[model samples]
Target: MCKHILNAQVSIRAPCCKQWYDCAECHGESQTHPLAKTAEMAFICKKCKKAFRKNMSEYEESDEYCPHCDNHYVIEAKTPQAIVGVEGEDARVDNRMLKDDRVKQSTNRSLFTINSDDLTDKVG
Candidate 1:
């Protein structure tokens, strides 16, 4: 069981392998090296989907609202989205059989509801 769940609040790009992680703890547990203080950090606003550079002076004093869309960043596990598949196979596929799950890439889109009874806020 993971102590902290990787959610939509923020993500850190590991300096060791340049891979995105939910936090330093995630990086430390998943990676071999420790995260340095000088390493770059970026926060993604769940509402706007815009990345806020942590190193920036402007962002250092910011709060919960996104600077781009002013939408409150929802700090929770996002709903599972429908996975979409690529049209063609990989060129260097040496194996004859391709797994069904491997054929498609999972993508999470924005949380804007077009039409639903669950939607309470109306933006026009």
Candidate 2:
């Protein structure tokens, strides 16, 4: 297994080209265009090539494995950190929802949703 696979840190899915790359540096080096906006990105398991929404909810299971590639991994749950949006020189977390208690609750739900078509692997 590659070191990234052993570490369980998945590769990034470039929204612009819809291809997987190791990291932002890799994308910047290999591609001519700029990186995709953070909100419009996903991650793929290095081993199995399984895709995960940015919230990473899909890989939360203790026995996480890619249904497509059957690559195994262990991902520990992490504390919720403020998600900041970076646009050129400006960086900020939209605070409009900060007043909502429900938004602060740690839950399995993701802030953004994925369309069924956005998912590459169909389990059925």
Give the Cα lDDT of each candidate.
0.59, 0.59
TM-score for candidate 2: 0.36
Instruction: Estimate, for each residue in 10-123, the C-alpha lDDT of model 1 and write its tens digit.
Output: 555665677777766778888787886653456666556677755533444345567688766544665446689755666467444554565664353335745475354446
Give the residue spans of candidate 1 off by over 4 A.
1-8, 56-60, 71-124
- Point to the candidate with the largest TM-score: 1
For 18-111, candidate 2 gives per-residue lDDT tens digits of: 8777656667877999987754446687665567654443435643555566565446523335578744532345555344456564454443
- What candidate 2 gets wrong by more than 4 Å, as runs, is 1-8, 55-124
For model 1, the local distance difference test gives 0.59
For residue 108, model 1's alpha carbon misses the true position, in angstroms, by 70
Error of model 2, residue 45, in angstroms:
1.5
